[model samples]
Target: MRLSLTPLGVLLGAIFSTAVLAQDSDTTTITDYDVISAPALSSDRIKSEVLIEVTTVGTRLIAVGAHGNIIWKEGDDWQQAEVDTSVLLTSIAFADEQNGWATGHHGVIIKSEDGGKSWKRQLDGFELMTLEEGYFENRIEKLNEQLESTDDEDVIGELEWQLEEAQFQVSNIEAAREEGPSKPFLDLYVKDSQTVLAIGAYGTFLKTEDGGESWQVISGRLENPGGYHLNTIFGRGDDLYIVGEAGLAFASYDGGENWETLDSPYRGSLFGGHLDAEGRVWVYGLRGNAFVSDDKGQNFTTVDTGTRVNLSAGTNTNKGTQLIVGHSGTILEIDDQLEVKNRTHPSGSVMTDIIEVAEGEWIMTGRSGLLHWPAKITEEEALATQQGAQ
Candidate 1:
């Protein structure tokens, strides 16, 4: 499970750092949320909700979310980075100290080479509008072929009716396709400094070499065969893994050239996965299910997380491996032995990302912008204090 980096890996790491150092200040601000239109949903209006994801570049801690919001921690205070475009950002990743990337809906991929001070859109799927048009044309052709093959009068009548419905749907699809792939990027991973992989809804998976300069669609069905939405992508060395709805998991060994589905232990949506230095892989998802794979995901053993709230992201820290900021801002800490040592609530805000800033001090962000220097109390410690008070 623990694979040593080759000399190439070290070289790539250095190059990534160099890219970061070369980043320029291109930060923009979110002056007004009204500028960005809310998503249109049939059942309800798409209210802009704050979604948070955290990562470190050098010593800097960065969290990004809806409306192109980027917050970075400097010593004690957190400052918002000025980002252009009011698109909803879902995830961010750093290639090195200064170079990073943030992705969101509407084919938005913003890159920052000098830390996160500035950002520029690298690639937009607006060009893919043609693909959507072609999709509808193909559907119409298939329906016409079916109608011609039917012979019975009643069957012909039914087929004609279905054909009319198909044409109507296709027309709608054509209109939307003309708008482009508004799917956005849900999760992203930097496989060293040169390679990056991004995944999102509608089985969208994109990969880029030479940093974020160019991108191409990799392996994924237009509509996932399993009908599950992909939530996140994780990479170690040349191996890549993705998890999403319905306990679905997939792996790519040859740098994402080919992918094969893997058996998952549960049947719920997985939010994310992390690989520790010890080579152990941990994945958490819906309804408080946490599974540990000691053998690089060949097998798994379920761990008791003690809560049903969905977990978004987790990482290993000095305090121990922590599952931070999930449903309702729930924070769960697992010690070196993989035991749940403590759980605490720092805020009523739903936590999207958590990072240990210094020793016991941590920083967590969610829908309510950035919170600085949150307190971390172990579960046993909190319990003893409560008992004494009684």
Candidate 2:
């Protein structure tokens, strides 16, 4: 059986959960880990470690993954930078060649000034809980005052429940602070050195304008009533897209100030999304399903990828070609003609993310550790590689 790469970060996020028992405050629970800051080990052998996200910083390529490891290719060798927090990092984004941000479990967000060399933690779940505590505490107080003057029993009941919920949240945050930060930020969007957006499971949306100096929760602007896990955020032109589990998706036109939920055709989770220069939005996820929209998601048509493996990562090449990688080392390449120009079938292991290292050569990382393939991988080459192993 081929190893599925979709678990790269998605698997880590799914396993981590904060189960808050509301009915019984004494029995409330949350996932906690004693995350410690450690120097990301630098070694040539580190390539075999699980890596989830990869991005290009000017002329350099950087990859981050499990154990808060950040590996970058400076010259011809891979080097890991010193970073705090040995948690599972889900994604990374570069605002420019000089600055970047990486996110992972425990609500960990780290930033680097010199490309991907070294990082410092800018925000964590403990701080977020502290902020939430203040917000909820204020709300609860206001609700109590409203309940005091209310004459109608109906209104009083509503306020009472609201107050209870707020109090519950405050206590939950308190418990979380004691247990350590466990909420994992799954994806990130770095607009610049000062402004950024970090999203994660359970409608966890945060924004910072002063370069993570202070973050504000903006999940209220989204219509995720069920609190679906926000999987990925992407943009092209003037539009920004957010997508995640349960076929949940939304689009923002005037920046993230306002968002409109787009109707998703698939009921399963969408792992990632990409936008082409031609205004086409491509979202791919569970079981190899991908849909493309030309009119900003008003209507969508399936891309008809001929595989059942979940697509883990999708990006546009320097030549505007689209490449998608997924479980079983499958690679789906779409050219300017909007066709599946080339495809590599399921190899032995899952390929989580793919990067074009040099023109025709590509390097991918995932559960299998690392793999090398052609930019336009084909069925013949995939089969030959599989046959050679036998």
Candidate 3:
């Protein structure tokens, strides 16, 4: 008798392994009570714990998570936005106050030209994989050139064979890329009003020049044969910075054409990064790890974040650099001088994304739903409100 494993079984196995690895990497023990409960939304087919990124378009805020959960916030409440697929949604970005896009597992890409009020499926992952193959072939050509200039005949022959093999491998990759979107995008960044950059698992990086009309894969060192997972991408003018698992940080000067790795102070997953008005770089990651880089990403210094909970996302606000949302809805606010001012716990849920809308008003999204200021309230304000209510 022969036993064969189905694709579903293989996928479950992979997810299980990933969860195990995540637990193994950290010393903290995660219990059933620690897991955030999923809200009773319209759909229950997808996993509720899969939300990774969120962004806003005008008064509307779009949040994506596991199983294609596209939620939009209207006023103080959140409602599920209809989407075609149930693939895990990871990241979303807005080019303006109107046009926006969301990506997720299985090469899933959705676009909303109407400020994320509604989203329509645009492109899938298969096409992106094809573009990546094309981009990789271009790199192989350059590698072949370097091999040809070498005096070592053995090395030249070896590299030539490798190039030929790469061509064949890329052909297979092209087929896979064409297979369509599978996994949700991990993070998305708007380079400008037109260009957008997205990165994900397996070092996947894609770019769109003509808004979301067309897209091209911008390969990175992490997407190479032996690449690492990239968690987030931060854009500043013509420069782009990426941080990921194992404290991986890379900078691209000429857009995403070339990337050089920066020495990270810690060896943990980096979740978020931002450039202040003064051009200072602030990055936060797992275990409450935070770093400040004054000179682009050339050097960094670890700062006291006061908590060891994983920091998911951060942004520059008028009050200072506010890093709200992380493990267990922990909100940490850092001043311009890199001082931790306020640290409050809003909810038991894990906060996946945070964005500053106005001077004091901030919007944060997590596992359950939308987190808005003066509505759901922050930990600090909630306490004050409770005291006044009494």
Top model number, TM-score: 2
Question: Which ranges of candidate 3 are over 4 A from the true structure?
Answer: 1-51, 74-80, 137-149, 153-183, 220-225, 357-361, 372-390
Q: In terms of TM-score, how similar is model 2 to the real structure?
A: 0.81
User: What ranges in model 1 sit over 4 Å off?
Assistant: 1-51, 128-173, 178-181, 221-223, 376-390
Compared with the true structure, model 1 gives a TM-score of 0.71
User: CA lDDT, every prediction?
Assistant: 0.62, 0.73, 0.64
lDDT of 3 by residue, 199-313 (tens): 8765667778887788877653443443455777887766779987667888878877778888887787787888877788888877888998888889998888888877777
How would you encode candidate 1's per-residue C-alpha lDDT over 1-390 as one tens digit per residue?
111111211321222111111111112221222313332111111111343677788878777766566667657666667676556677899878877888875557778888986677776546333444454466668768887887788987866765564455445445545433434467898875778888765455777898877676653333254324577888777677788767878777776777777778788778778877676777887777888887767788888888887777777777457554466557778765667744556444456667776786666655544544454444465456435534
Query: What are the models' TM-scores?
Result: 0.71, 0.81, 0.74
Per-candidate count of clashing residue pairs (backbone under 3 Å): 12, 1, 16
The candidate with the higher lDDT, 2 or 3, is: 2
Per-residue lDDT of candidate 2, residues 171-233 (tens digit): 766766665655568888887788898898667799999988899888668887455678889
